[model samples]
Target: MKTTLSKIVLLSLWAATTSLFADSHGDHDWKPLFNGKTLAGWGVVQGYANYYVEDGAILGRTAEGSPNTFLTTYEKYGDFELKFEVKVDEGLNSGVQIRSHSRDFGSRR
Candidate 1:
């Protein structure tokens, strides 16, 4: 709930409906990615920021002397729907990329 680009807990589904949080996944067959208690099954790549679990949500805190960090899932998805809530400072660089293994273009990685 308080993380950056890729710190969200993903729920993959064949189809995404408006009731993504209707207290049920019977229609969409959603599968959660993150456990919400730890960073298990996730990997950090491409940047130097810090990501961790806190208060039943993931937190991605940017640090000095670091580029845009990514907390990616270990498993790959062909196609899916994602619903998330994010809180980041205005004007800070952040985004989530789906199905693309490549980093942003012109990265100083």
Candidate 2:
């Protein structure tokens, strides 16, 4: 019951670092989208899952009886290489939404 998009290309990365900066390790063009400390530039556009920062990582916890939840950046991005590390517990499904629109929101509770 996770809500995600189906046709967008974007960058979604989270690291242990504490700030957004250019990659000093050769590929200076690499941009870090998260500061790795808090969810400062992200927001929940729908649903009731809980998102929070801990150990420099973003965690999503689903609440019983709640609908599928979505957390997205305040700015829109497209056509970019995406790299990320993820760990999903049993019975939990998580994914990067590639594309989305206004009509994608809400469902019967």
Name the top lDDT candidate: 1
Q: What does each candidate score in C-alpha RMSD?
A: 6.6, 7.2
What lDDT score belongs to each candidate, Candidate 1 first?
Answer: 0.55, 0.53
lDDT of 2 by residue, 1-109 (tens): 3312111111223532223353546665655556667888777656776677766666666667776567776666654554445444345555667666544433223
Model 2 quality (TM-score): 0.61
TM-score of each: 0.64, 0.61
Candidate 1 TM-score versus the reference: 0.64
